[model samples]
Target chain A: MNKVMLLVDDDDSLSKFIKICVEESGALMEVKQVTSVDKAMDYLQNKGEFADKSRNPDPYVMLLDLGLPKTSGIDFLKRLKNKKEYAGMPVVILTAMESTENIRNAYCNYANSCLIKPFGFEKTKELMKSVTTYWGRYNRLPDRAD
Target chain B: MDKDNPLVLLVEDNDGHAQLVALGMRDSGIDHELIRVSDGTQALEFLHKKGKYESSQQPRPGLILLDLRLPKMDGLEVLKEVKSDELLKDIPVVVLTTSEAEKDIAKAYEFHANSYLVKPMHFDELSSMLQETGFYWLACNKRAY
Candidate 1:
């Protein structure tokens, strides 16, 4: 079965591109896109409109964009890592930031991996392939129930 | 393994297994120096730069390849220590071990291991895994430093 991927990015076009890439890479079954950290948290917590657990099964992996409109990805990461139940979820920072400080900050906050957004379509696709192969296929993720 | 290459600290007690890992990494497209430690204690010592490794020339490793069933301290213990420590926690630790036990898998993730892989029986499979690992973790994945 294809795994679910939760994508939190403010850019609609980029998120759509990532969804296509992840599906084409044959790693994930579906992509749930949320524009802000609040929405992402609502989805994860199964709150409000995201109340149906069956429809919103926990994501196997999360691709977070750092430069969100509100509640930046770094702060969201810190919050997620602090929550006992959500702490085990693997978070991969998918951002355009190539700065050393941002990279170090993400890692220090316990991001499982960080991927700088590739400039070209093919490069982005290739990155998605690597992400899927390693995280989706090889890496042993925590049990979904956990 | 070239000295100038990024260092990969490998913790495995079995000599034959360690050699196989070295061989696998040798063919992995990314080049890196492989530092071998037999037991969990040695692994910690090497990472902490304590014990005999106090004057270690190698800087902190960019990545760690750890085995579960080890002597002295065990892989899970080593993983917990590394993940909890402020300085060493950022370095990715991939649990490379033989056991496919569900318990081991769960425990490794609980401690925040970057990834986990059950060693394949075939040499070719091992080599393939090493390639993928090196390609992703070394080539694609961003480092904190």
Candidate 2:
């Protein structure tokens, strides 16, 4: 089965654009967009709307937004780092914020990597290609037997 | 070291800044394909080939241009994951954000990020920085993969 990618962001429109950018690469990418921190956690935790495999499978990777409402992205990172079970899951922060404080704080919490949001679909297209190529192999996840 | 296929991965959330980075790379004629992600979570999803990114469109990146500040996970989380993973650890991850904080830089190095770059806010300065970044990372540097 193909791996899943969860995109959690409050910006509804940007979410759509991100999906298109990944798809435009034609890499068999399945982009899932959630609007809030709670919803994103649900997707990762396999609760709520994310429980269904067809509708929302376990993401091989997650693109998280930092400034999420309800549960802040930083808080979410802390939770993941705190839990050994989910620590192996590679989580990259992608957001509009570019603050030194956030960067330092994220590393202190043991985040995998921090990224600012990209500009356009064209550039995004390129980013998708690179991300897919490398990230796909970084984690040696268990191959779910069909 | 100047291979175009190994592409650059730019993980930035700001649309305007992202454009400048792309343009800067373009101006330098690095001729490398760039993949940009908005947040750290997205960056990880893309790197791990999970979530919406099961299949891959291009080859692995030669360099990663990462932004320190991100929405969900932030850059440090992303960096730790990349460095910890045996398969992806060797791949260069360059932190590119606007933080001049010493702690941020020190922590990034501690996580084993390949490099750190503070993004210039000014358009002209940013452009020059991008060009230099492209030249250094894409051209001058010796790439392992």
Candidate 3:
């Protein structure tokens, strides 16, 4: 079965690029894109429009962007990690900021991994390939009840 | 060396498994230096720079590949201690073990392990997994320190 990935990022172009790269990587993964942390939470909880389990399956991994409108990615990470139900979820932070403090904060908040948003087409493609191959294909997740 | 090529500390008691991991990393062609410790106690000692490691000049490892079962101490105990330590918590600790029990997976994540990966039974699959693991953590994943 193809694994579901929740991508929370406001950047339309980058999100589209990542979606394309991940799909093209041949990893069995379906990327669900959301612009805000609230939308991501909704998706995860199967609330509102995401009520259809078939359409919105539980994501095995989440690619979180540090920058968001109100609830920042770091803040979202803290919230998610605080929930024991979301303990097994792997949240990988994708950000353009190379700030040491931001990176430290993300990991300190229990982010599974952090990767700089790559520049240009080739680098992004390579990154997506590695991301999908590693997280989607190889990394194992705890069993989640449907 | 450089941030892109950080040292990897592998904590495993099995000699054969450790050798396979080294070979797999070599096959991946990613520049890395792997230091091995046989048990969970030594793993913590190396991380905290305790006892024999007190005078060691090795820089803080960028990644830690931990095994669940070990002599002296268990992997989960080591994981809990590392994640609890402010200085060590930031480092990515990926649990690499043979057990795929649901309890183990859930527990590792509960301890805030960076990731959990089951060691493949076949030699070829193990090699492939190590390559992907090494490539992703060492090359693709960015570190703060």
**First chain TM-score in every candidate?**
0.92, 0.87, 0.96
Q: How many residue pairs clash per model?
A: 0, 56, 0
Better of 1 and 3 by TM-score: 3
User: TM-scores across all candidates?
Assistant: 0.90, 0.51, 0.97
Candidate 1 on A1-146: residue-level lDDT in tens?
Answer: 45667899999998888878877776655788999999999999899888988888787779999999869999999998877677557899988887888988888788888888877677777788887777667777556762
Give the DockQ (C-alpha) for candidate 3: 0.72
lDDT preference between candidates 1 and 2, better one: 1
lDDT of 3 by residue, B1-145 (tens): 1236688999999999999988998787788889999999999999989989999999999999999999999999999999999998999999999999999999999999999999899999999988888888888888878
Tens-digit lDDT track of model 2 for A78-128: 787666456445577776665656655665555555566768877666666
lDDT of 2 by residue, B1-145 (tens): 2335458888999998898889988886777888888999988888788888878776677778888888998889998888777666657777778887767866775675655667766888777667766764575443544
What ordering of candidates by lDDT runs from best to worst?
3, 1, 2
**Which 10-residue span in candidate 1 chain A carries the lowest summed lDDT?**
A137-146
Q: Which digits, one per residue and each the tens of the lDDT, describe model 3 over residues A48-88?
A: 98988888988888999998999999999999999989988
TM-score of chain B of each: 0.95, 0.93, 0.96
lDDT of 3 at A66: 91
Predicted model 3 interface RMSD: 2.0
Residue B125 in candidate 3, Cα distance off native in Å: 0.5
Return whichever of 1 and 3 wins on lDDT: 3
Task: Please report, as a residue range, the 10-residue window in candidate 3 chain A with the lowest summed lDDT.
Answer: A19-28
- For model 2, what is the error of residue B17's alpha carbon versus the real structure, in angstroms, after optimal superposition? 36
Q: Which stretches of candidate 3 lie over 4 Å from their true place?
A: B1-3
Distance from true location, Cα of A104 in model 1, Å = 1.9
